[model samples]
Target: MLQRKFDEVVKKEFPNAKDAKDTSIHYLGKMQIEHQLDISKVLMATSVCSDDINVPSTTFFNVLFGPFVMGGLGGVPFVGQTGMTAFAHHIPDNGSAFIFYGPHIGITLEGDLGKMYRPRMEETGNSCGALMLALSRLQDNDYTPVINDDDYQQMKLEESLLPYRDEILGSDNQAKAITEATYKIIDKKIHEYIKTCKNEFHVDKVTLLGGVIINTDYGLDDYFDARNFEVIDLKGL
Candidate 1:
């Protein structure tokens, strides 16, 4: 019933879109999810790696919470609410609930997406282009027409980036540079969060599930471990 409702919603919103055929994994999880999908909780980690800019909820949720989990995790307040409300229309009141946030987990789902969706590498430079490529591959798919091809070009111009070249993005140094920048952002946010944390909620075992959890460097894993919070690399699963 939930699946049927989701299909109806998706079809209503994107009339031209095709329902991705149900496969082994979907089948396996279908029945359980219809009832109690073991995992009771979920957290979405979106990217704030780049400077603050607006992004659509669908894009963010796909990057943050694709690959169906036990419960609904990533969605915006408005869209997610509507979608989940539609979902709850079928679900029992005793079933699991859902939630969403604005880059609460610092997952960096846009790792390569921001740069890769460009039509011309000449327009945005290779770093951004490569990032898009990385995002596609990370999501196990390629660019579709829905993505804005021109966004990267405009972003490049805003950043005053140099000419486009594949070399800049395909290098170990480039990856490291991106990683470092992301870490700085994460560090600041986490530090701020830790400082403000004065209660049990701060110390509770908070599980992180997003792109940023993939990083073993920056001691993110260690930091969470030390705090006794479970830093789950859900992306790996």
Candidate 2:
């Protein structure tokens, strides 16, 4: 498992962190943990960097998932770079962190979250890094941000997919219906990812952060069954 792999690595690098009961990760890293894990509630936050062009244009929506559930910034400086760096230094080394990169689903989501989160990308100047700092603060054991097999399955449920309510519905040609084709493609990939992890972990809830996630056009809370998964809009807080 990714967490196990990470925990092993952390044990070697920061031995002192093992004692800390809590830690935090910044920038969401490369892994994640499902809400079903036996852990305490950790604070999740995201921001819209004043500058955003540095982020690749292909995987914006995927990026939102990392920060929202784990915690971090988008692409700005103080909000993203400096903040993430500082946050990482403070975490006791036992907690977890999650960071999202824009290129993962940039081409897939069609830049919807990117344009919506910071409509005036030209004006923001790409300084979104608060969440990144938060992720960096985590200790490998204290926090686990990787997304495993179980987490992927829970994310597929109509309710789990609700966080992306806007992308599923919109005003442009891309925004119409959750077509069978699109769902099929997403479902295939999701199922494939789930086959490798522990069965106990599941994406019961999703936390959203970053400028792109916050500025999204669809109000997931409005249409989706909030009872299933709570969407934590982590833009300002």
Q: Model 1 over residues 1-237: C-alpha lDDT tens digits?
A: 543443444334224322222221232253246434333232233322222111221232432232222111111111223332243233223333222122212222133312211222233333233333333333332323233456542333222212222333455544433433333333344323322331213112223222121111111110011111123222332
Q: lDDT score of model 2?
A: 0.27
**Candidate 1 positional error at 69, Å:** 20
lDDT of 2 by residue, 1-237 (tens): 533443443334223322111111321321244333222332222332223432222232333323332121222222323344443333223333323211111111123312222343433211122222222322122433444565432223333224444554442422212222233333333223223221222332223222122222221110110111223222322
Write down the lDDT of every candidate, Cα atoms only. 0.28, 0.27
Stretches > 4 Å off in candidate 1: 1-40, 43-47, 50-175, 198-203, 209-229, 232-237
Kindly provide the TM-score of model 1 when superposed on the true structure, using C-alpha atoms: 0.27
